[model samples]
Target: MTDTAQYQHFNVFLAHEDHKSEPYHKYLKASANYETYELKSSLEVDGILYVKVPKTSQPTWAKFAKSLTNSSIDELQNNSSSAVLIIRAPKATMAVTFGYGRHLLDMECFVTDFGIKTALNTLNHDTLRSVDVITLDEQGVQKKSQASRSSNVGVFGIDISKDLLRGVTGSSKAGVGLFNISGSGTTFSFGKKIKVKDMPALVERIYSYYQSNDYKDSFAWVDNIRRLEEKKDIEPLNKKLIDEISKTNPNIVISIPEMLDWDTITGFSFTRTKRNIKPTIDSSDYYSSLDKDNLSIDSLKRDRLFVFDSSDEDPEYKLYDCLYFEIKGSEKTYILFSGTWYEIADSFVETINKLLAEIDITSLEFPEVYTWQETSGKGKVVEKIETEGDYNERAALEKNYYVLDKKLVKSSRTTTSIELCDLLTKDQQFIHVKHRKGGSAGLSHLFAQGNVAAEIMLGDRKFRVAARSVIRNKVSKDIVETVPLEKLDSTKVEIVFLILGENSSTLKGNLPFFSKVNLTKAYENLRQKGFKVTIGGVDKVVKPMP
Candidate 1:
């Protein structure tokens, strides 16, 4: 017998109903290099375990494979340091077992009818030698297959399926350039410009990425769970009712649909209008007059204001009749509600109270409110401010210094004044600044903000006029008081996204490359919108002061 020490070592486990088919035993016995043993009851093995299934139907083999993936197999893997399972079955049976084993067990296992057939074929050819023996090592075996004259390319050793290769390459023609089968091994090239010497490193990187489980496993049991979830019946929202109500004017007082009528229900309608309002008149009175005029609400316009009304009719208990919500500049105020002017206020009064029943008052906490000294005298009283903090200040500063070069003047101090774009330049540049501090910041928010800002600026005439007035006021100090009217038009507005702290280590964390990839995709989308867009990170904008 050949010296067993020279060849790869494996512990064999034969799982058969009866001793009818024992070709695997004969084959293993003939190979003097392998130390074969029968697995009695315990799965604990010192070496590799070859589970030989009887020559049966595919379904039966699959059931057997699944049954073996219980606690016993797990215990075997936990106890044995170099435990491996080689499932030898029929072609169809092997495929089923291979998939199941990979999904359920972490142990290094493989299924093959070809490996057994090749081992049996070795008896005839005296010169035949085992090129690569499957081992218990985490890294799987690699084999090299010849490339055929046909477009189909075979890569041995690497378990990349043909479908996976096709999906990655996109086309069969491109597949040839990416993968080339050679005598030594299957060489993989990343791109057309990649050097031949760097192919091995690239292949190793790909292998490492896959092995690390950075991407979702195709053979994972989670896939089946996800597929089952996808098959579940999920009811969609009623779009017909939403579409009908969305287009209807809140002032028109259209009757509610019988199907939608419910107790204590509220409905909201949003509409954008180019209707001009004088700053001197009360906003509530102006909005109320629009309702009386029976003006048709156009949902397609920009700078949309939402109107909400509840079904409650009892006047004594009603909190509001109809809430006309308007967000002007940065301030959020309910300008009109049930023919009453809504002003944000605070009233503090000392109260003497007795508990009717035992209450959990310890859990309650008082809300914080901003207050300042009204007068400098001894009898000075504290006055509360409705709002606090300038959230748009940082974005405004970023836009002014980076994009416009501090050319434009400061617009209105309100939040909605320059919420979208801080500066409207002489060259028709609309600059949107986004500052992020943490790694979990999503690029989608930045994209949406910039896109919506551009959309409103271009589509809404009243908003454009207000924007022009702000820009005109700024430019009047530097240039002539009468700036060209054509400059205010949205015809040649170029959007610039000034991103601050984008490359900060705190903002990008471990997956730094993914941020760049996401940004590139966002850039492409903005460009597709017919806007001349430019993205500049903090590094590109900030330079050493000379």
Candidate 2:
């Protein structure tokens, strides 16, 4: 080291391998105001920028203080600076940067995730001050957070844990980025910030930072989770989705992602502007939105589909916005739902899909039924009032089906009554049905309810007695006497999740990712109890709103 060398903090940015030899102008953003510096060193270019902009607005506290009888407020102006020091090396161009210098450069001029890779390679994880973590699942369930508290290091925010290691800040022999944040942000840096007296030292730091980036992962703990994709990884996964779906027989399909009001959404169209369009219950019809010729992601974004009002006009629930598509990557599975991207553990998605496939889904058969808002009821006029459960219960009774939709079986143990199933068929099928959407979060409760009911049906004999008695007491159908009681055979009982849809294919695609995980657990638990479990995507009979 030079005797005149001084310590300084600087972030490092590595140019994309392809653009290593590009001119400095190509590296900077267009019309960037920067002054050149003459170092007379082996550096290609040394540029610095000082920005002086007026504050957008005064602080609220400043205004309130000035409102006092006597107060003085000299608003401070904003003064910030950034520097870009670049050196052309063999096969690559490395830049020693500080502050928001990159704001003055082409956003994509540098390599992607180079900072994080370098930090993981260079820094010591054990003594690191903080780490950022994020989690995303195929269900569109997502969470991103940062923690200053290590089990050993103090954590800053409460309830913060690592899901994806985005940034790390702490002391390192190779130095750290500004404020110690690395990898997950715009810049990868080395050395602490300070006045630089020696030009040679800063130039050397650039090469060392590059070396730190090229070095293989040596931090055992940090490298352990590198196999997982960062939550912020979007474009690459999106391209992967496009590629995977382009393949023949891709196990992916367009789904409704959330529980939408099917009653209002008579059908869907890809083109937002269409007249007298036929309403289809399925979401896959996004292609058939009257402009079926061009079905691509670009089209989905450009010609966002809209759900129409009952008269096929004056509605703007963007269909494109609600659509969800799932794809499995090499290591993780990703989903694009409600216009956001999320990734799930490939193992979780695959396991759930496999388990879901095991439970045969029979086509649900029912009249065109829906949640109706009766406009001419007893008192004030309501729009649509009959709930899905009410429809199911009434339909089951009319057909002489053993109706148990709301008949609660009191649990002698917990003083709680559990609904055995929505409707029980004479053929020994105990059906549990839900009119639900949104995502896994919404369906989780339904799955939990079904699982608990299934367990109680098989193990709790007292509950079974109460279940049959409730039907016999509340139901007018004589078939209530035939309801299984006194002696129960688990093998003979069939537990079905009746979904009001055209077929199982819809459920397979539309069901949320985490809901499928819960379904898998429920299926296994029920299967172990010697019962046949299935998902029924039944046909719903539609009647014009009464």
In order, candidate lDDTs are 0.29, 0.57
The candidate scoring highest on lDDT is 2
Encode model 1's per-residue lDDT on 59-143: one tens digit a residue.
4345566686654432222111222233333211111122122222211122111222212211121212222222111111233
Poorly placed runs, candidate 2 (over 4 Å): 1-12, 38-72, 84-97, 115-148, 152-181, 185-286, 289-299, 307-320, 326-335, 340-387, 394-432, 435-497, 502-534, 540-546
Pull out the clashing pairs in model 1.
11-48, 142-157, 143-157, 329-415, 329-416, 329-417, 330-415, 330-416
lDDT (tens digit, per residue) of candidate 2 on 37-127: 6554343334332332222566657667678747566762345667676656554576666666666666576765567666655566445
Report the alpha-carbon TM-score of model 1 versus the true structure: 0.25
The C-alpha local distance difference test score for the whole of candidate 2 amounts to 0.57
Candidate 1 lowest-lDDT run of ten:
348-357
* Total backbone collisions for each predicted model: 8, 32
